[model samples]
Target: MNLNGTAALVTGAGRRIGRVIALALAERGADIIVHCYQSRADAEETAGQVNRLGRRAMVLSADQRDWNAVESLCRQAWDTFGGIEVLVNSAAVYRRTPLGDIAESDWDEMLDTDLKGPFAFARFLGPRMKERGCGKIISISDTAARMIWPGYIPYCVAKAGVDAMTRGLARALAPEVQVNAIAAGTVLWPDGFDAHQQEQALGHVPLRRAGSPADIARAVCFLVEHGDYITGAVLPVDGGRHLEG
Candidate 1:
C-alpha cells in the first residue's frame, strides 16, 4: 500500500478530478498510465505533470464505452508500465436527462460508459492484479446515486449501478485486490455552469461549500495506501451534501 514502486492506471485522467488523482498518485512515487477519451491535449498535460514529479507516465486514448477499447487500454497499460498495481475507474460521462426525455440511446450510452465500461476494464485488468496477489481498484461514483436528482435520471441510475458493481467486485476480489468507490459531491460545476448555478448547487451541501478535486484525490490516495482492511466500501466526499432532502 506504500505505492513507492507501484504502477497505476487512471482512466479519464485527462482533466478535472481524474487529473488530480493521477497527479496525487505520481506524488506518492507511483508511475501512471493516464487514460483519456477525447482530451489528448489534457491527457498529455497530465502526463507532463506526472513526469515532472519524476515518475513514469504514459497516455493512452480509448473510449471506455467500447469493450475492445477497454481491453486494449489494459494491454497498453501493461505494455507501458510493466504491470499495474492500481486501477482507477475514473473515466465517466455525466449528463442531464429527465425521465420523460430519456431515450434508449441515452440510456445505452450512460449505462455503457458509467457501468459496463468499468466492469469491462476491471474484468480485463483484474487477473493481473490477482496474479500479483495485490492491487487496488477505485471507482469514482456520485451523490446522485443515493439521492434523486430530477434532471439527471439516466446519470443517477448509471451511477447507482456503478455503486452496486463496486460492492460486488469487492466481494469477489477480496483479500488480494481491494475494490472501493468514492462518491463525490459537488466537486466542481459542469464546464459551462456559471457562479449562480454553482451557488445554487452548493445550497444542497450541508457544509455550505463545494469540494475540490484534491479532496476527492486525497480520499482515493487513502484507499490505495492506507485502506488495507476496507473493501466494498463507498466513501462519500460530498461535504455532507447527501443529507439534503
Candidate 2:
C-alpha cells in the first residue's frame, strides 16, 4: 500500500479489534499513535507489536467521551508523529441498553463515547489534514446500526449517528481528506460468552463462523492504504450477515 511516510492515530488500541488495526497499519509502514483509556498494559502490548513491525509507535491515554481528552489526544498525536496521515475512530462503548431500561446516564455515555468522540476528533484532525491536502478518517460501526437489535438499542443508535457523521465529514472535507466507516457483524464474540453461546451465534452467520480482529483490521488497512477514491462509504465486513439480519 506504500504508506511508508504516513502516520496514523488509532483509538481504543489497547485490545481486540483496535489492537489488531494498530498493528496492521504499522505493518503497512505507517508510524502509529495508539490510544487507550484504561488498558495501559494492553496498550503497551499493542505498541510493542507496532514497534516489532519496525514502525514508530507511541501510546496515549484518553477517555474518548471527554472533549478536552479528544482534543489533547489529536494534539499529542500530531506532536509525537510530526503529523497524522490517518485517523481511525475505533474507541466505543458497547452494551445492551434496552430502550425501556435505558437510563439517562447510559444513553448519554453511549452517545458521547460512540458518536460524539469521533466527531470531536475528526473536527480537530480534519483541518490539519486539509493543510496537508490528503488524509483518511475511518470509523467503526456495528451491524446493529443497520438492523434493530432489541436489547442493544442505544449502542445501535449511537453507531447510526457515527455513520451519519462519517458521511457528513466526507462531504465537508472533500478534495482533501476522505471519511469512511467499516460496519462489522458478529466479529469477535463478546466477552463472557460460553462456547455453546458462540456456536449458537455463528449459526446465523452465512459463513458459519465468526470473524477475527484481523478481518476488521484488514478492512481498515484497505481503506487507509488503497481506497483514496472511496469517501463516505460504509463497507460491511459482516460475512454477509447483513443480508439476513
Candidate 3:
C-alpha cells in the first residue's frame, strides 16, 4: 500500500526503534499517531519532528496491557485521522529474568507488557483495518525468541508470543491487511549490558556487529510501502544473527 497521505499508529514512539519507525513513516508521507506509556515528553518531541517533516502528527499515551485504554487509544486514533492505515506494535519491555530469580511479577510484567500489550492493540485494531479493506500491521519482535537467550527467559517467551500472534493475526486479518513481524537482534543493547555481555551477544552474529535502528526502519518501510503480497512472515533484520543458530 502507498504510505502517502495515510495515517500510522506507532506504539512506543517516544524513543528508540519506535521513534525511528514513526519518523520513517512520516518521511514516506504518512501522518503519525505516536503512542507512549510514560514518555509523553519524548513522544511530543517525536511528533514535532513529524510535523517538521510536513506530516501531521499527534501524541497519545496508554497502558497497552489495559483493554479499556487500548480501546480508547484506537478510538482517538481513528477520530483524529478518520482512519489509521498502518499499525506498528512496537511497545514492549525487555528485562532479565534469570531462572532462579524469576518471580510471578516478573512473568506478569514481561508477558503483559511485551506480549499481551501488542496483541491487545492488534486485536482491537486489526478488525477495523479489515473493515477498511486495507492496512499493515508490523510488530517488532526479537531474535531472542528463536535463540532463547539465557537470563532473559521471560523476554524470550514474550517475543515468541509476538511471533505467534503475528502469524495468527495475518490469517485472521486475511487479504485486506498484511500482518508481519521484524525479529531484531542486538540492534540496541540494554542498559547495564557490560562489555563482556555485549561481546558475547555479538559473538553469535555472523555480521560481527550490532545493527542500527535504520536497518529495521527501512524494512518496515518496505513492508508498508512495497510488501503488498507479504503477510504472516517474520523478516529478520538481525544482521544475520538469527542465522547463527
Sorted by lDDT (best first), the order is 3, 1, 2
User: How far is each candidate from the true structure, as Cα RMSD in Å?
Assistant: 1.1, 1.3, 0.8
Please give, for residues 184-221, the per-residue lDDT of candidate 3 as tens digits.
98888899999999999899899999999899899999
Off by over 4 Å in 1: none
Candidate numbers sorted by TM-score from highest down: 3, 1, 2
TM-score, cand. 3 vs. native: 0.98
| Clashes (candidate 1) | 0
Alpha carbon deviation, residue 230, candidate 1 (Å) = 0.5
Write one digit per residue (lDDT tens) for candidate 2, span 1-245. Answer: 35898999999999988998998888889988989999999999999999888988899999888989889878988987888989999999887777777899998898999999889889999989978898999999987788868888778989999889989999999989999999998777677889998888777788888888899999998998889899999998988888886
User: Which residue pairs collide in model 1, if any?
Assistant: none
lDDT of 1 by residue, 117-204 (tens): 9898899987778887999999999988998588987888888988999999888887799999999998878778988988888888
Scored against the true structure, residue 222 in model 2 reaches a CA lDDT of 91
Identify the candidate with maximal lDDT.
3
Model 1 vs. true fold: TM: 0.97
